[model samples]
Target: MNAEQHESGSWYWEVGSEQCPHGPEPDYDTQPEAWDIWIDRHTGSPQDVRICLDAPAGEACLQCSEDDGEMVPWESCRIREHARPKQGVVPNPGAEHQPVTVLVGTLECLDRECDEYFGDDGDEIPDMESCSHIREEQACSCQRQDDGEYSNDPCPARSLSVTGGTA
Candidate 1:
């Protein structure tokens, strides 16, 4: 995925500003570096490539204006109506503006059927690498040993099973 459509893209460029708000003076670095610094502020770690932002209710609905200044609040700026979701062909404006009720940090595993990956205390199973027995025999796409040999534990299917058990 590219930067343009991501939340990070909003702060990816200094535009009319002379320097990044958090990094070395704008004079010390190139435009791209300034952008990288700006994006880093909203992220938890320096290595985090993407920052998931909640486009404030009505703020992210408007497209950035050409005359808009560099220091304006980008996260709250409305997304351009013409901008489309990169993963898919068409942009669904209706879906885009809907507030995301799910926050990342508080999410819990709810899959009832995934007893092997959960503990008696109703928490995610510890030692995910050794959960599945079958996983020991099958290598992952990286062609390495399956870490979760006892349970085949944390594949995409099993990961989501943490919440309310699989249907």
Candidate 2:
């Protein structure tokens, strides 16, 4: 850290690790030495300067001297991609004695209100093709109540078949 008095106000700037044009700047060995030099030129304590550093850069820049102002740490903080739920209408029920057929498809964030699927790109979609719950037929096998004795094979009950979807 280094400071120089200007006409408007004094300013502080840090030069660290990197080689300076004039060999090394004053007190370049350690952060404490740099702090000492910075304090000597400024009127605040080291703790005060540290508080400023810990604060968010947006507010820090607003309050701190323009020459020493730093930008917010944007690179350190960012939102990563999130898995969004795909959307599609469930198929309607089929005719009598037949189970309803449904084809589960994936839909990107198309509606503005749905938070789960809201996305900027229309193509970004959740994996609906691999969902095991989606089957080709609604119901395949049937189960019957077992008799007390063994070999309680009974008539199969009416069941729906899975038509299509991710499966």
Best-performing candidate as measured by TM-score: 1
C-alpha lDDT of candidate 2 relative to the true structure: 0.29
Lowest summed lDDT window (length 10), candidate 2: 143-152
10-113: candidate 1 lDDT, tens digit per residue? 33333222332353334425577776655545343233332223221122211242224332343323331111111222323444222111111100111122
lDDT: which candidate is best? Answer: 1
Going through the candidates in the order shown, the clash numbers are: 31, 8
Query: Cα RMSDs of all predictions?
Result: 19.8, 23.3
- Candidate 1 whole-model C-alpha lDDT, 0 to 1: 0.31
Error of 2 at 139 (Å): 7.4
Q: Alpha-carbon error at 66 in model 1, in Å? A: 4.8
State each model's CA lDDT, in order.
0.31, 0.29
Instruction: Give per-model TM-scores.
Output: 0.17, 0.14
